[model samples]
Target: MAWWAWLLVQSVVWCSAGVVAVLWWLWVTKPHVDIPGPPTLPIIGNALDFLEHPVTVNKIRDFHRQYGDLLRFYAGPKLVVLAAHPDDIQHVMVTSKIVERDPLTTSAMRSFVGDGLLTLNGSRWKTHRKLINPTFHSELHGNFLEAFHEGSLYLSELLATDSAGGAAPADVHAAAFSSAMRSFCIASIGVDPDRLIPDISKHEVSAVMRRIIVLMQTMMVRPWRRSLSLLRLSSEGRAILMYYAHLRKSVDEVIALRSAATEEGPAKMRRRLLETLVKPGGQTAIPLSEVQDELMTMAVTATDTTAMLMSYTLALLALHPDWQDAARRELKDVFGEGGDYLRSPSLAELASLRVLESIIKETLRLFPVVPMLPRILTEDIRLSGGRVLVPKGTILYVAPFLTHRLPQFFPDPLKFDPSRFLEGRSGEEHPCSYLPFGLGSRNCVGSQYARLEIKVFLATVLRRFRFLPHSRWEDLENSVLSITLHTFKPIEVYCVPLQESGL
Candidate 1:
């Protein structure tokens, strides 16, 4: 053979050898877990499964039913293990070695949130968490009551206007999202939306946020699109970048306005979370870039998750009028039957809302806004009483959606029984089983704030209007697990004035 032909043959042989060597290495180091899941396709693994069914709650349930509590699958070449059993979840959640979130998901999130708490790992996350913790303290919650009340009132008015005095049905999610966004702006960012961006409406802001979140979710599940340079070349990626820029510009305006206001002296500054983060005393001052990222993270998480929680709770209450009546009775007892139903509940009064709280808890149990918590293993770990070995560098998904539905943890898990949470019933369950706000050191820090906001909104809405079932109320079960949980269609309900209902 000629020299050129010999050289080509040699290159082909070397390339083949290299590919075989890599395959051998992967096979030798792959996770030894004996868990069963849907058969994976070569290179792609079970990625097509996710692509076919992007909203994976039902599929996950099917897998848990077919396979046992612990199941293994893959996203592209990444080895993924889903831990549905409380024991396995506990092992993953509490283990110090499993501190890092899945890098692929984190990389996707970083485009929107930068190095904020949601995407950050290690000491940086620890520091930011410590600094932000005091802002959500119960003592400080009272400071946000005015904003929450105002937002609640705004929602009531919006609903009233949209429904034309109870003659029409309103999209509960949209209204709740608007209300939550308005409240988040005032309470967390210390800027009034009306004053800061007079040109922008709550609906506009909410729509932009929803688009951004949808884009982020898309990037998360489709790992191949995570490359920023490549993603920016696509239309969907460009739209997301535009949406993120729009959001960041708004937040940057707030930061600039708040920073200038801070110069006027401490007396002029209200005790808003942005103020605390911008000028966190005696600690390392958070960088401006980090502050922006943190605010963005707070904006998406606080508003979207809280809105979904409120929507789901209201929808469930509408389906179950007895529970609604029971919640109203509790509200009546706290605020009085003849008093102002629109009045804002004080922190103590909000705390007194046990029945309402139970209903909210049950709603979360049924539909956790963040269904799956993804983490990457830093060290090899044995689960299932040492029967299965999940190798280091493997991706682990501690699925609260699946774990919360386990028959062992929650009896008849599909049923929406608010009473299950009342009287300390939830305390009897495994610690890792109920993870609506997540568990362990890295759990959501804004959980208390979220609960407070949801309570205020629910109390205000329930007091003003009774939620009547809409034609699509049963569709709440059909949810899409985006960055946050969303239904296949917007959740709609008829809001009847309490006066008309003669409650």
Candidate 2:
């Protein structure tokens, strides 16, 4: 009605228009660096995708089918690019700029294991890598063969005691973890856990490992809980801190014992990796904290991982009796029917078991324990295949699970056939296709050790027992991703003692 009133209303309308215009400009032209990915809600991005599909392997696999090799999505506000193609994986892992681990993954891992080689980056990573590299050399693993033999014997006895008589099914994974942990203690810390640290059994370590798994799965699936403040408020998070404290204490005890032995006796008396790390010759001395971090990293990666692989391979063999019999025959050929295999076999003899190696390789292809290896690009990466733009600060995940199953790399990838790994077939495939131990400079350090442990444990167990599947293969297909891929329950198998099987 009044001229002044009209002017006031016009001012308010113009202010609102200016605000909307600025917002629109920011929304449309902010930055178009995002790669192809699933649809996202405003602000939330693709965080819900993890919640809907908790199993990250299947989620990445399904996304690859829908979005092709390279796809970008947000974990909370952070952008992550999933590189599924073998070429892209190779490029990211081997050729990418400043191939450091994603901050989220590194932070989470560090929270559990401290700043070990697995979590370190740049100069620190390089220094530690050089220091720790010699400890896992092929020659060093040979000294630990007796440990493997003893651990495998303990596992067999444990199974025998559990099954007692009459084809009773036992948890193969349980046995595998027990043996693997002891072997790790023996090889890494130079201590027989059963004799020195009776209480630090797989049962205890697994309880801690399970909690760590829950903490990781929770943080991954629920982006809201990924924050340090939020995680500290949760029970699983608190349990993780407590577990780490306990782990540090136990590791310290082992280190102290090793140190005393090394100090009191000649250097020749000490052969374990811990001795080398504790009293490194001609290398920079590693800090106790750093040693603990590396030890924890090895304990988690080498022990349960190799154990799980052994269990999965055995389960697969159980499901396919032909392969089981074939592997057993190969074992017999190499070890000569319980001659030295039960006590100790040299690395050369172990490597001679080609069929068993093939089976393990195939199992790793199908059920890669560390299914998704993640790296963060410090700068923009134009992928090799499609020249996909993975922007700087972008987290790239190399999904071996998806790439391993691609028909291009692996024919009939679902089929549990070890023949594909029998030399010529797998050698013909892309090198990046099989990355159960990851790729590039930052690939798993204990890979050689892991392979040796698997071969030794498998040969020992298969020699003494015949594993029969307790569940259908289809049921076993469902796996939970927690740093490593694992079945929801312990994989059960009928452990028929070789004498009873009459093979």
Candidate 3:
């Protein structure tokens, strides 16, 4: 053979040998776990499952049914374990070493939210959490209560206007988002959204946010586009960056206005969360960029989650009038009957809303805003009493949605029963079984604020309007899992004035 032909043959042989050697190394080094899962395709593994099915919640539930409590699947070479058992979930959440969020899931989030509380990990997360914790104290809730009440009143007015005084169905989710965003703005930054951003409407900002979240979720399923550098190369990635820039600009403008106001005097800073956050002199002073990130985090995380909770709660209540009446009676008892229904409930009065709280809990159990919590295991952990081992470097998904539906944890989990959460009935449930806000030390920091905001809105709105069933309720089961859970269609409800409904 000629010299060139011999060289070509040698190169082909060497390349084939290298590929075989790498494959052998990967096979030998792969972590071993005694877990059963669905059959996977080589290289791609089970990624086609997500790509083929748009509804992730349903697909995850199907996997749970097929593989039992602890199931494993590969997301394009990444080993992902879905832990539905409470003990396993608790172990994963409480372990200090396992505090890091899954890089694949959070990479897109970081671009949108920066390194805020939701995406931060390690000592930086700890420091930020420590600084932000005091802002949500019970005492400060009173300040937030005013914003909540105002937002709720605005929500009622919007619903009333949209429903044509009970003649038409109203978009509950849109109204809830508006209300939640308003309350978040006032409480977090001490400014009304309308006044702060005069040119852009809240609806426009919401649309931008929704688009950004959908793009981020798209990046999550396609592992190839997981990193920012790789994502920027695609059209979707560029769109996310553009949308996020708009969002960040709006938030920064609000922060700048709030910061300027804070500079005026200490008196002006009262009851403002931004004031507390922006002020210097802590043991570890936070940078301005960190403040902007935290505020943006609050805007993205708090508003939508609370709005979804409110929408789901109202939808469920509309379907079950008896529960609605029961909730109203509780509200009547606290605020007194035939009085001003629009009046804001005090901190003590808000706390007195047990029936409303139960309804909220049940709604969350049924439709958790954040259905799946993703983490990456740093060390080898044995679960199920050491009978099963999940090796280090594996991706872990502590699915509250799956855990909440487990027959062992919640009886007849599909049923919408608010009474299941009333005091004594919930005593038998595991601590980690019902984590609507999440579990462990790294759980949502604004959980208390969210609960309080929802209660205030529900109390105000339920008092003014009686929710009736709408045609859109049939689409409730069709939810899309983005950064947060969202109904495939807008959740609509018939709003009848309390007097007209003869309540």
Candidate 4:
């Protein structure tokens, strides 16, 4: 044989040997626990499976049906256990003693949010939760009622103008986002929306936030950038750094102003949510970095999710004019032909709008803003009704999207029946069946705050205008999964003035 031929043959033999040795090692070191999942190829595992589904919640739902509650899949090299059953969700979210967040998800978010309540785990999470809980109490939220009312009115005016008094379709998602963002700023950050610095105006800040959410979702799915050094050089990475810098700069300015004002006199300072964090003297004077993280978390959590809920609820109500009429009738009875229903309602009045509340609940159930909740298993967990053992370090996912759709919990699951959520009408449901805000210790801290904002916005808008179906209404559910679910296409609806519509 020729020397070149001999060399090529040797190389092939050695490469084959190396591949065999690696496969042998993998087989020997594989986890001992038996769990059901899609068969994975070596090295890549189920990465291709994820790539195929990408943003499809239904694919994951199919896996839940096929695998029965817990499906053990590998993303790249990481083991991910998807838990869909209410019992499993109850244990993972509420019952599990270990509540550490999945590093993969939280670490990605920490860049934008810092070590706030959303990203923190263990003692840090506990500490921040305790500190922030009081800020969300009804009294403080009540103070923001006027902010919600104002924000909703602003949205109504903007929509009416955009629609040319219901002569054309207006993008409700855009209007809802602006309205919710404004409400979040006033209620959570304690800032006047108009006064937010020109450099980081509401529209600019929203652009930055949208960039961050989209980039974060992209990174989480692809995860190609290996390190901070490599990531900083990429286009997406560079853009995020710039946008986050703008975001942080705005937050820092607000913090600085609050701090200086705090120094002047405690009595003079109005205790808004942001002020509560920066106030001097507590078990721990929260560092500015921590406060910024919490603020970012609060901003991200409150804005998109609230907007999504409002947009979806309004769209659904538009589809069912009878329900819209029902809600408006309730509003008319409570506000009596509208003399400042925009202002705060009494607790008694809020309770009376049961139809609107039910509609919101039903909307949240059909389209949960945070579709998948992820956690890291700090300890080994039992799975499949205790038939399988899941090893530690596995990523656990509790899918409220899947749970909310299960037929056992929701009859005629795909139906848009607001009456299903009416008090006493709902049959015995698994405690974890309808978790639009999640469940247990780590449930969304501002759930009540979100609910109130939605109620205020819905009531204010429905009273002034009637939502009529538009051209884009048919594609409302074609949503892309950002950090929160967002419509893949813009959603527009006709906003007819109540008087014009003869409602």
Q: Which candidate leads the pack in TM-score?
A: 1
lDDT of 2 by residue, 1-503 (tens): 69999999999999999977775554444334546788875445666777654464555667788887677786545677777788887777776634688877777777667888878999989988887777887667766787788888888887787667526777666677778878888887777676543354445555556566656766655645665555567776665566567667777777766565534345453345676677533231677788878888877777778767876887899899999989877766766644354446678888788888889889988888888887888877788464556677777778877777888778878999899977657534776777888877888888888888888888888878878778667645667766787776667778888762225
Candidates' C-alpha lDDT: 0.78, 0.73, 0.77, 0.74
Candidate 2 worst ten-residue window by lDDT: 262-271
Q: What's the TM-score of each model vs. the native?
A: 0.89, 0.86, 0.88, 0.87
- Please report, as a residue range, the 10-residue window in candidate 3 with the lowest summed lDDT: 262-271
Q: Which runs in model 2 stand beyond 4 Å of their true positions?
A: 1-34, 195-208, 221-243, 259-271, 280-284, 337-343, 384-386, 426-428, 500-502
Per-residue lDDT value at 498 in model 2: 72
Q: How far in Å is the alpha carbon of 252 misplaced in model 4?
A: 0.8
Could you arrange the candidates by TM-score from highest to lowest? 1, 3, 4, 2
Which ranges in model 1 have alpha carbons more than 4 Å from their true place?
1-29, 95-97, 197-211, 227-242, 262-271, 279-284, 426-428, 471-474, 500-502
Model 3 segments beyond 4 Å from truth? 1-28, 95-97, 198-208, 226-243, 259-264, 267-271, 280-284, 426-428, 471-474, 500-502
For candidate 1, write residues 1-503 as lDDT tens digits.
Answer: 99999999999999999997886566555555687889877656777777764554566677789988888987655788888888888788775447789886788889778889989989999888888887787766777888889889988998887777778887777788778878888888777777644344555555655555666667877766566566478775565566567678887787667555535355632355787776533221588889889988987787778877877887788889999999988888888765465566898999989999999998888889888888989888989977888888988888888877777777887888888889776433787888998887788898888888889988888888888877444588676666677776667778888862227
Clashing pairs in 4: none
Which candidate would rank higher by lDDT, 1 or 4? 1
Q: Between candidates 3 and 4, name the one with more favorable TM-score.
A: 3
Root-mean-square deviation of Cα positions for candidate 3 versus the true structure, in angstroms: 3.6
Compared with the true structure, what per-residue lDDT tens digits does model 4 show for residues 372-394?
78788888877667777778888
